[model samples]
Target: MLRKLPLLVGAAFLLTAGPAFAHVGAGPVDTFSHGFMHPLSGIDHVLAMVAVGLFAVNLGGAAIWLVPSAFVGTMMFGGALGYYGWPLPMVEAAIGASVVVMSLAIAFGVRLPTIAAMALVGLFALFHGHAHGTEGMGLGVSFLPYAAGFVGATALLHIAGIALGLGLDRLGNMPATILKRCAGTAGAIAGVSILAGWLAT
Candidate 1:
């Protein structure tokens, strides 16, 4: 099961990396078109969304809903800002950081106070929303449906993480330390990639 986790995660990496890079510097339609698919659009989004899922599954109970809800709520707020042509500082940096940091949280068991976790995830969602909002120039698609698509995709990734976490359950309460470690390592690698890209640009 543990071995499978790495492979599953790696597959996610292969799938997301290219699309994510394309997302940077795109026009409204490009942003909107891809942003509509953004949660699954790139590796960074995938890792962050999956991290939320893993954290909830590991936390159990209310956390399952709480974490995801916070993400969606904050994400929507961020989207509104972008749709309205608001300027946000460090948007890409924040998005990349969310991926690297959250993945590490899952991988390394770097549990934060529940409030902290919510706040952290919320921050990430802002950039995500911003990217989505500005992508289509506020006219490429109907805002409600477009927003719905992003939220749905985010939820799907969360579910995938939950599925992976549940699969870990079969290992008979094996220490989550291992899973955390795996998540952290992946986060680090992803973070480096994001940083490198940011630097180049």
Candidate 2:
């Protein structure tokens, strides 16, 4: 199982690294489905979302729930700000940095107090939510339903990360840790790529 971890992460990277032109049409339907699919449309969102779950798992205890909860709550707030056309400077850079930092946290097995972890996660969520909100609103979708859909989708992605973390735990601490680090390394590489793209633009 541990030996295959790299391959799994690599496959995920490949699967998500393609042209993100699909997101251009994400709001075309202006329905719950469109909102739900928005996060999954970008590799950056997926990596950051999944990395949050993995980070929580590494932290253990109340952090497992609190961290993600903070993220969801703050994300909604951030989305509202975006919907209102509020300025959030450096959103794209922040989002890319979030992936890099969170992935490195997992890779190094960094543990923080639950509050600190929540803060870190919440900060990242703000950028992500702002991006989603700005994009969704621009498409003329109903804000409430679109928010609900994307929030639900984000939760699902976190759950997926939790599930993966749990599966790794079954392999015992050392191997699981190694595997997670491999996954994080992949995330870091992805983050660098994302940041580069933003820089180029």
Clashes of each: 8, 0
lDDT digits (tens) for residues 1-201 of candidate 1: 333444443443443333333443443343334445756657777887888878777667777778878888998898888888898866766676676666666765655556756776787788888876765454744556656777778878888888877787666665556766676687667765774574221
Report the Cα lDDT for candidate 1. 0.67
Give per-residue CA lDDT, model 2, range 68-89, as digits (tens): 8888999998887877789786
RMSD of each: 7.7, 7.4
Best by lDDT: 2
Task: Estimate TM-scores for all models.
Answer: 0.76, 0.82
Deviation from native of the Cα of residue 64 in model 2, angstroms: 0.7
